[model samples]
Every structure is written in C-alpha cells, then in structure tokens.
Target: MSFSLTTDARETFIFAAKNVFRDYETTPPAPEPITGNTWDNVTGNEVKEAALALIRDGKDPAKDKSIQELLLRWQLSQSGIFPVLAAENENQTLINEFNAAVKGLEALTPAAEEDAQILANAASRLTIPNLGDSYSGSPRDAMLHAGARVADARLSKYAEAAGTLLYLRGIQVQGEHMTPNWFALAPLTFKDAHRHSLRSAGTASPWTLAHARINIEPAANIEEIQERINAYTTGKRAIERQVEAALPQWQNLPRDAYQDAITRAVNGETMRDARGGIVTWAN
Candidate 1:
C-alpha cells in the first residue's frame, strides 16, 4: 500500500479539520458511490475523534483531508487505517503495464508484435462514443403530423371567418383566387395528410377527397409517412441494446492485458486509497 498526499502534506493536514463538525450549520452530505471508490464505516463521533487525534498529534485538523474523509465514511467504515496508496496511481498503473507488454514483444518471436498491436488497439477502443445517427429525439413523423394538425386548424378558422364575412356583408372570398396555395400550401397539406390520415377540409367533414390533393390543376400526391415514427429512435435504441448486451465482455478488457504482461508490476499486492482503504478496482 502506498499513500502520498495529493498536495503538500502540511496543507493536507491543515484543511482536514475545518468545519468538519459544527453547531447548527449544514454540513456536506455523504457521497454516493461510483466506480473506483473506497469505502469506510465509522460513526460521526468516532470521525470527530479521528479529527481531534490529528490535533493531539500536533497536526492541524482543518487541513487533514483524511479527517473530513473519515467523517464522510461516517459510521459505515469498519476497515483498518493508514491505507497507504502507492506513489503511482491506477491510471499510470495501466499505462506502465501497457508499456511493459510492448517492450516484452520486442524480446519475443515475430508473432509477438501482432499480440502487442492488439493490446494497443484495445486500449484505444476504451472511450465514450458520440453516436451521431442515433439521436432518438427527432420523431420526424410525429412532428410532421403535429405540424399538419396546427396548419389545418389555422386554415379552417380563416375559412370560417371568410365565410361569415361573406354571409354578413357583400364581400367576395374566391378561395380559387387564393390559387392552389400551390407554391407551398398544397404540398404541406399532403405531407400533413399522409402522416396523420387527416380528413380534407373545404370539402366538408367526412371529406370525400381521396388524398391530400385539393381540386387544383397540379396534383399533390405523395406516399404516406412510415408507421414507425422516427428512424433515429429505432437506430438509437438498437445501438443502446447492442452495447448493453456486451456488458460482461467489456468488464475485463485492458485488465486482462495488464495481467498478461511479462512484468506484473502490481501483482500479489493490494492498492490503497488516501484513507487507507483498498482500491477495489485497482486490484
């Protein structure tokens, strides 16, 4: 076990004591654990004692990271102390192992180069993917359908107002004079109709018009939108499932290579955290 202070040792000692336990003030809450964490179980009072012990030994409590850290461990820690973390950390551990493997290949037969190359490739493959084409938020078909409904509603209202105006007064509303609205409106109407199976307006309810076409000169016939909403959603879901299904295979990748190196740098040893607990993942 190797433990070294991240910063100056005295400074580390100084900061570990400040406001670790105070009266009527909000203290930092305990942390939620994630990968590569070391845990401890000790009571709040016991933690306070650990801090006081630092002061007893002529050390500063406010600066002792371990004291505040132990406080976070907070009654759950039953582990031993002086968890000596190594001078070298886990990330460097892997790099050192990789370098050792590459070097060993040089000392071996011709086939050794190929094996080392595989190790290099595997190391590089460990990363998060951007996954561009798999964005599931587009919902193109659904959006098109929604847009159509809004457009139809607005058009219907306008037509109704025009009809009311013609009925009440002597103004003319030549919808044909509005033309096919062709340059844009007709095609938009067809898209909306195909996606949503919308009924034709102006032709009245239970619309008799077979397609989204108006009685205009040029036709507006296009295929209906696909039933499966969005291509992106399906594509993204398939990718997510594929990656999830490979979970077990992903667990030991570089670690296997790390162990296979000719020189096992950290073999038969336990890695320790700053608080003297075992670095679980490092092992």
Candidate 2:
C-alpha cells in the first residue's frame, strides 16, 4: 500500500504503543468484540469496502460533484489500488490511506476540481481507530459523557480527527478571543444553543438546539464539515452503534462527537483528581 503519515501520526503511535504495552491508561478504551462478533470475522478488505460504500452513498451527487468523484475513488479502493495499510499501526495506516485516498481521488476527478478540493478538505479530518485496551479497564471510557465543557472540547478534537471543521461556539468576550488559528485549520464558533443540542422527547435523546449559530473563525472553514457530515453518515452511524452497544450504560449520552473532540482538543491541557474532576494543568 502507499506509504505516508497523516498529521497525527506521532500522537497516534505513542497512544497505540501505550495501549498495547500498558493497556491504555490515558485514553478511552476500545470496545470489545462480542463472542462471534462480525467484526472479528471481517477482514481488513471487508472493512475497507464498508468504508468505501459508506463514502460512496454518503454524499449527494447533485449537490457535491467533488464528493461524487470521491465516491468513484472509493470504488477504486475496493480494487486494492491503494497501498497496503499496516492495520496494526492504526495511525500510520490511517495517515497513509487518507493521503493516498485524497491523491488518487484528485487525480481521478481533475475535471471536478472544486469537488476534489472539497473531498481532500474533508478527508483531512478523518482518523484511524486508536490503540485501545479492553483487558484491564472498564469496557468504555468512564469519562466519555462527562459534561458540557468537556464535551465541547472533545467534540473539537473529534472534529479535528474526523476531518470535520468545527467552531467553538462560545461567547466572544472580545472581538478577538485567543482561539486556535482558523487559517491553518477550518475552525468556527457558533452560539451556545446551536452548538449544544438539548434532548427532547420523540426525537433523538441528545438532540441539539438549532437556534445556536456558528461564527466563522477568521481562519477555519465549515464547508468541509458540512460535506463530511454528508459523506460518512453510514460509517459514523456504524461507529455510533458499536460504541452504544459496547457502552449501553451510557446510552442517550450527549454528543459523543463533542466529548471525543473536547478530549483531544486539550489533550495534555489538564489532569484529573480522585473524583475524576478537573485539576490544574501540571505545567
């Protein structure tokens, strides 16, 4: 398979190693496959194919020509044109595959330049599964659905990893808040209500409010976030299902994307004390 590294290779590698050696002391635990789980029987090819099909049907061809072209590229992935991904090295493989997928997608659909750009843009946030430990720890991350602020930070990280452009959606104390550079990344902010959905009956339990609106961080963009939301719905759904099944105790939990994003956003920003509450950053 094509060889390359995604932006988060260094962090992923260290994380994966720790999972294998120390059983993931610092991060969320991977879900365990149930006895006779389909995931275990499924080969890497099957998983790749699943990803391809999800990408293929995820976007609307009429609205997103670039995504249409990307759909074709995903079809090609099914043929094994892509490089051999080192499955054991989730970070390396994800990085390599993401890079290769974008390059191949671009080459195949040069005519749809905008579409290609969009695909590449969204693909940037996609990340491989992290190293996880199921043996010693609880079946899930105890800190998964901790709180709103935590969820927001983790949501940002999830967006970063999944290639979804995100905004902090917080009140701007001043015209200029010290936020991440949107120029280098596609960051934005929205009204709290819009960014944070509240649960309502007869609808998704963790439904977010629509009133909150996003503020364009000077440097970040959300066009790709929209595209990502469209393109990988199935895969995302599958992940959601798997996570929910694994951690039924936390069902109806708020936006997992938010939680994951926040966790990664301030990866080393804080420490937790005995009650699992935040402590001052060691630094």
Candidate 3:
C-alpha cells in the first residue's frame, strides 16, 4: 500500500538518523585482549617456593623493598592497571631487581614466555563442546555478532524513514532494504505505479505515485541539513546569551589571569564549579 509523510516528519526522521550515524562513528573500539605469561605461572608452587627462598635469604633491606615493589607492579599490570607512562623512569630500579629474580627462577625451568604459550595452547585444546552453542559461536564472538545486529536494526529504521520521506517528495523508490545491507531505488512512471497499485479500481492515482523510486543521497546529506537547521534555530542573540551564561564572571578577572583562564578553558583543562568558581585542575 502507498503512504506519505509530512515535511516536519521528514526533517525529524533525517535529524534522528544523522544522530544515530554520529553516535555509531564516535563509539570507542573494543579493548585489546590480555597477554603475558606471568599471570599464568605466578600461582605455581615453584614460584611460591622461590619467593619464600628470597625472603629467607636475609637480603639487604633495599633489595627486599625493590623486590616487593616489583611484585606489586606485576600484579597491578596483570589486573590492567598498567604503570603510568610518566612513572616509567621511577620504576626502572624496581624493574631491574624484578628481572634479576625472574632470571634466577627461569634457570630451573623453561623461559616464562615459552611456558605461557604452552599453557595457552593447552587451554585452547580443552574447549567444552555445546558451550555457547545457542549463540552459534564462542561467547565473545556471539557478543560481537549481537552488537552488529543491533547496529543494522538501527540503520534499517533510518532507511525506512528515508524511503518514506522520498516517497512524500514524489521520488520513485525501489528495493526493500537500505544501506549496510543492500541499496534499492529506481525511477517509476505513472503506468508502473498503477500496475503495482493496491487500489480496488486498478487505476493510476496520486497515492500510487508514493511508490516512485527515491534517491538515497538526500537522506545521506543529513549533516548539511542539520547545519542549516541549527543556523536557523540558533540566532546571533541566542549565541551571545549562551556565551554570557557560560562565563558570567569573565570580565571580573585580572587581565593576566583572564588570559591564562581562557587558555586553560580552550585546552579543556579548566571548568567552572557549581558556584561559578573557576577550577584550574582536575583530580
């Protein structure tokens, strides 16, 4: 059946679709998978024995402190709270001591990297059957697939809205699907519309023309349309008011402080507190 939409509806749908695209593009990428063999070997009886031996050896207090710090840093790294880049130099002393201890332990067995790889391979081979079968793949893979499905569903809604808007504009639209799946649109004549009509009289009508092919480009120009809409809605006076509201006490600051504050604000390192006081740093 043929259908149509009003101009306001078309604009609103286009605006919403653009927002969806913007959000999708700005979403953060997934985190990297965990790595390294220390996590796997740290719990072994041999590792515990070696750690105890080091403690009982009556090592210098400074050496013992470095060993303790190294262990703490290793545990923190395993938990994903990696050492800060700026603190690397400060950690070098502890890292050297940790490496010495690790080297001593390695002399009695395979290298830590090699041992970790062996353990990883062994775990992979011990996979359970029928686990996550309902998802058609591993749990992590299934989760990614589900996310893609949701994105596709959202895009489909935008496509439908675009098609409706085009139909209202008297464009011939063809195809049942839209972008990220398939593109369908073709020109149509009155006779073609009539032939595909659902009307009881089987005659050509304005409603049948709603099935006309529509170009996808207009809907894709959402950014340009949004800019135009914003320009119309946000007048110069409104912008001035917003600026005044955002920095109400800008005129009261000393000249030097004002320039510094402006620089910090531009760099996103400063902001106004609840009481309109300037906060120069973040915790």
- The residue ranges of model 2 lying beyond 4 angstroms of the native Cα positions read 1-146, 160-283
Q: Give the number of the best model, judged by TM-score.
A: 3
Residue 136, candidate 2: Cα error in Å is 36
Sort the candidates on TM-score, descending order. 3, 2, 1
Ten residues in a row with the worst lDDT in model 2? 198-207
Worst 10 residues of 1 by lDDT: 216-225
Top-lDDT candidate index: 3
lDDT of 1 by residue, 225-264 (tens): 1111233234324433433333333344375443222112
lDDT of candidates 1 onward, in order = 0.31, 0.32, 0.36
What's each prediction's TM-score?
A: 0.16, 0.18, 0.21
> Cα deviation of 187 in candidate 2 (Å)?
7.0
lDDT (0-100) at residue 201 of candidate 3? Answer: 27
lDDT of 3 by residue, 194-272 (tens): 2343212222121112212211221223233334323423432343343345566757767776545534443447667
Candidates' RMSD to native: 34.9, 27.1, 28.0
Candidate 2, residues 109-146: lDDT per residue as tens digits? 22222222332332233221221222233333322222
